[model samples]
Target: MDVTFGFLLLFVATFLVAGLVKGVTGMGLPTVAVGMLGSAVSPVTAAAMLVIPSLVTNVWQLLNGPSLGALLRRLWPMMLAILLGTVASTALLVEGDSRWSGMALGGALVAYAAYALLSPSTSVPGRWERPLAPLVGLVTGVLTGATGVFTLPAVPWLQSLRLPRDVLVQALGLAFTVSTVALALGLGRLGEFRLGQLGWSTAGIVPALVGMALGQAVRSRISQQRFRQFFLAFLILLGLELAIRALL
Candidate 1:
């Protein structure tokens, strides 16, 4: 099979698994999928595959999550920061050296994973949290635009909140939705959203939905603590994987 076709298959499989993780735990779509796919293809392709599916999947989340009024009140500071940071980061995207961008992002994920496991609170604490929250959005935006690895800082911050399963899931879903739309626009401006690319990217929606459907059916069977533990472990391993791939 051609390398391109192989990568397309990889995208479907990656997001299918990502969708399962998202449906079961309410997050991890970009984290798991991008971590794996970024290793196999140009980060651009990995990100492109996610565009359509993420947009579709997050619509459900936006509707199902906490009320818009409540989420806006609670998360506005973080959201505004996200907008500014995404714009800045996307503007600086260097199509020239994405490998280095990948390396930087891979390292950031590793650092975040280490902190989460070692911190007593499993949280970043108060003052540090608010400032860093926006920075997280900034960093993730840069990586998302440059290397298609868009989970780093945001995931850790969100996870640190230690919200109830549903709240956390909804928050992640909403956040992902916002970020994905910004990215889609950025990619379009860069001429990265051609018809053929959009078509294949859109194709992943089927598997994404299917995986989420299957995950929802089984979500109740899984233990929350067990899922959290696995989630942390997955981040650690994924961080390591990206680092290793970049180094090699």
Candidate 2:
């Protein structure tokens, strides 16, 4: 594909916005980018585009935060679950119809948002927390690989746990890393990964990193509640887009 100046310009602007979200929140990179670009490109391409940028920004998060050992120990089960889900879903990619897929994705997001708003329980049960985290990882991995959507079914569960803010951010960064890696591998195997595609995708990280630098400065000023509200609102918009696309 010719690298149109139009696509490049859109890519730069979208990456900057996505980067700001990731820079501050540590996990919304793909979400924000995909949501914006999904309208302009096929979702598959959008998913592939994220691979390079996500890898770049996530490396920054891991370096700045440096909790790999702890995160690995804590999230291994979830990682494995995600891997399994990705493997199982690989075959479905070719047959996957985006409109129907969008419906499924939209339903999951809507349900998640509702749960986040209305769940009676504030935290996972002690017994469930250990097992459930990975289960969330599994769902997130499947959705991410199949649709380039990272509506991790488990994020709300994690949020409800209310770990220290930094730990939560570290955990999210790790989750993004795992999902992004799996999606890249699966897409590569399926031949959706390409050098030219990646070249453009790589350009997105510049804005993402800029967002991160600015995010650090703002993180301390924003209350967690405000961040949560903003994230939920974003999810709702994404979900609505998917749902409406499905209907159309």
Candidate 3:
């Protein structure tokens, strides 16, 4: 895709919205970006564009966590599963393909949106982690590899783990960072990565960061429940639109 001025603006705007959503809700950047931009361009392109900013933000999250050592010790199995799943899925599905990949990405978005809007619950028993970690990791990793959105079961599932607030946030960051790195490697292996796309993705971080800052400034003013409702509704529409486009 030639990076036209109009599309460039649209791309930046999308990231701004994504960043703001993340600021308000602690998630949604990848879901929003992939769902909206994937419809406009190829999902592959959208996924590629997300690499830098997403990685940077998640890395910040990963670095800020004080309990990294413990989290790593407890989370290694799940992380390893995620890596395996991502590598396998990306190798098989994402490279050298755009049409079916778009369809699948759209489907994943729709499913995730539906889950968020309908059965939203935040709490996971820590006891369940022993059995569910690998399963969650595999699913999330596959989703990350294919659609560049890894939060579906991961975020809510982690929330269910009911870790301390700070630890949960950091854990989510580590999960995202791991998935992002895996996806980056997968894209690189498939030769889908380009210097131009990397440049654009990196440049996009500025608007995203700016939007996050603005969102933080105003987050206290808005009703978080209502904001989440609206955000999920938007995601549903975006996901459906992309799914329809994929069929066409």
Candidate 4:
């Protein structure tokens, strides 16, 4: 596709916003970026462009956390399952229509955001975590493959674990990093992720990093609860717009 000035501007703006969200909340980079760009580009293209930024940012997030080895030991099954599930479902990216992808993305976003807003006090029992982890990973991987959004059950399930704040953030980083890599590999196998696309994706890292820095700078000043509410509300509106446009 031709990368016009307008498109480049849109690309930068999209990632900047996405990175800011991630910086503030320690997640949402792919979800916000893909959802915003899906209207202007193919879902495949949007997902492709986000590869570098999402991977880089999430890896940074992952490494910054305290308990890498333990988290990996505990979460490996789920992480491996996510990889398998994403690879298994990648054909859908090639075969699915844009409208279907849009609807699915919209639905995933709305469902996740709505569930988050409800803030249910649900927690997974210790006995169930082992079995449930793989199931959640597989389902999240499928959704990530189909829609390029990995927040739904994955984020919610992670929250249920009730890890300490910093550990939870790091865990999110690890999960998102895995999801981003899986999506990149899936796109690469289909020949949808090209050198030219990688160039653009690489360029996005600058804006994304800048946005993240800015967000982090201001993070302490704002009420995280209020900001999250606003963010989730914005997602619901964006998701509704995408779904409505696809259906019409």
User: How far in Å is the alpha carbon of 104 misplaced in model 2?
Assistant: 3.1
Off by over 4 Å in 2: 118-121
- Model 1 regions lying over 4 Å from their true place: 1-11, 35-41, 66-68, 91-94, 118-120, 124-132
Model 3: per-residue Cα lDDT over 60-121, one tens digit each:
66776579999999998889988888877785546445456556656766676677677656
TM-scores of all models? 0.82, 0.87, 0.78, 0.86
**Which stretches in model 3 have alpha-carbon errors above 4 Å?**
95-123, 164-166, 218-248
Model 4 lDDT tens row, 108-224? 768877877887455689999998899999998887777667775687688678676667778989999999899899988988899988998998998898887777666557664
Off by over 4 Å in 4: 98-116, 220-248
Worst ten-residue run, lDDT, model 3?
92-101
Model 4 / residue 15 / CA error / Å? 1.3
Q: Predict model 1's lDDT versus the native.
A: 0.70
Model 2 scores a C-alpha lDDT of 0.73
Greater lDDT among 1 and 2 belongs to 2
lDDT of 1 at 154: 69
The local lDDT score (0 to 100) that residue 67 gets in candidate 2 is: 67
lDDT tens digits, residue span 1-248, model 1: 14586776777788789888778766667657767676675556667767888888887766776555666666666766665555555644436565565576677777777776676367656778666766677666665656555566667778887876567667777677778887777777777667876887788889888888777666657677766766676677667766776677
